[model samples]
Target: MERKSSSSMRLPPAVQAAALAAVGGSRLQKEFAWMSWAGTVWRLEGQSGAVYVKRAGDLKDERDRTVWLAGRLPVPEVLGLFGGFGDDWLLTRAARGVPLSDPSLGWEPSRVARRLGEILRDIHALDAAGCPFGERKLGHVLIHGDYCLPNVLVVDGRLSALIDLGLAGLGDPQDDLAAGVWTLQYNFGPGHAREFLDA
Candidate 1:
């Protein structure tokens, strides 16, 4: 039987080539997760830097725009976009930090949480500009919606950038904050619950 249509299908050859064209290079790697649609992320290597491809008409448009608008705040640079009709993709430079699951994380969970709080505040502080990207409006300030350690990138003990922001959008900042607290509680486990919640 055919699978549900709402789910993302792999990009065909022409579609992939068009993405490559849009991003200005051949594909380097693809990022995926169970919660996200397939082929939503494509990484291409170019002489100048890396390019991240995102299919257009993808629901992720909001996050892309938010990150681009909040460029000074902290996010990977969006180079350009391609495709349409839900086939659109974006090209962006790669960030430098390793994932939060890195062994070193055990040494810095609390520090990471605090820094993440500061970064979240910066993103939430953007004044409402007449956004051209057509993203959902932040009733207060834009929130990443999924502000977890895994999504926060750090380098040289500094928060370098944020990724998996397609989930980013307008919402009560508490929604993101609560999730951050819960994620910390869950991942660290047991006795750390209160500490995480307090964060």
Candidate 2:
């Protein structure tokens, strides 16, 4: 299904202040999360560093999962979290490199497929014992439940970071595997999907 763009939705005033505070009152804020349905992301270039501020409604499980996985995974560091009127904003350091969805990167389909495969394999191989939400006895590892192409960032042709962790929890590993394959096919076509499965 086609998703609607949030290009027209300007960040609410409260959210903007929160973002500015996150970076010590920096004024450089750019809207960047165009395709996201869960929330709006702002790229804030502060005096100290760059951070991506995510504003969402009823965060539910996303906040906890992010905090839990911060030191254990290659995710962005959560600098702060604020809640107001049933909405929440998450401030995190900017992820390194470009997202796999960036067409300008000109990555070959097969190469992207291979990298995604390796990422999934590595994630599934992590020790579930340390995962607060994983049910290890059920053969579930800490899977990126939304392991789609856009959620993965590639740096120098390798998986650098994984974003969007609201759905991450104990579940069948195949869910992540299938989502990865589906994303490959959706983004690069059938040949790429086949290559990913084969790899």
Candidate 2's C-alpha runs over 4 A off are 1-18, 21-26, 134-137
- Compose the digit string of candidate 2's lDDT tens values, residues 83-186: 76778777777889787777878978888888888878888777656677756566777798999888888888777788889888677988998998889889
Summarize candidate 1's per-residue lDDT along 1-199 as a digit string, tens digits.
Answer: 0122233336556545644554455553344322344344555555345555555466356445546655555677765554567766555667778655456755556655566566667777776465443255536456776777777787776777777666565567778778777766665653443444444
| Top of the candidates by TM-score | 2
Alpha-carbon shift of residue 93 in model 2 (angstroms): 1.3
**Which regions of candidate 1 deviate over 4 angstroms?**
1-39, 46-48, 55-60, 104-106, 129-139, 167-170, 190-199
Candidate 2 whole-model C-alpha lDDT, 0 to 1: 0.75
Model number with the top lDDT? 2
TM-score for each predicted model, relative to the true structure: 0.64, 0.84
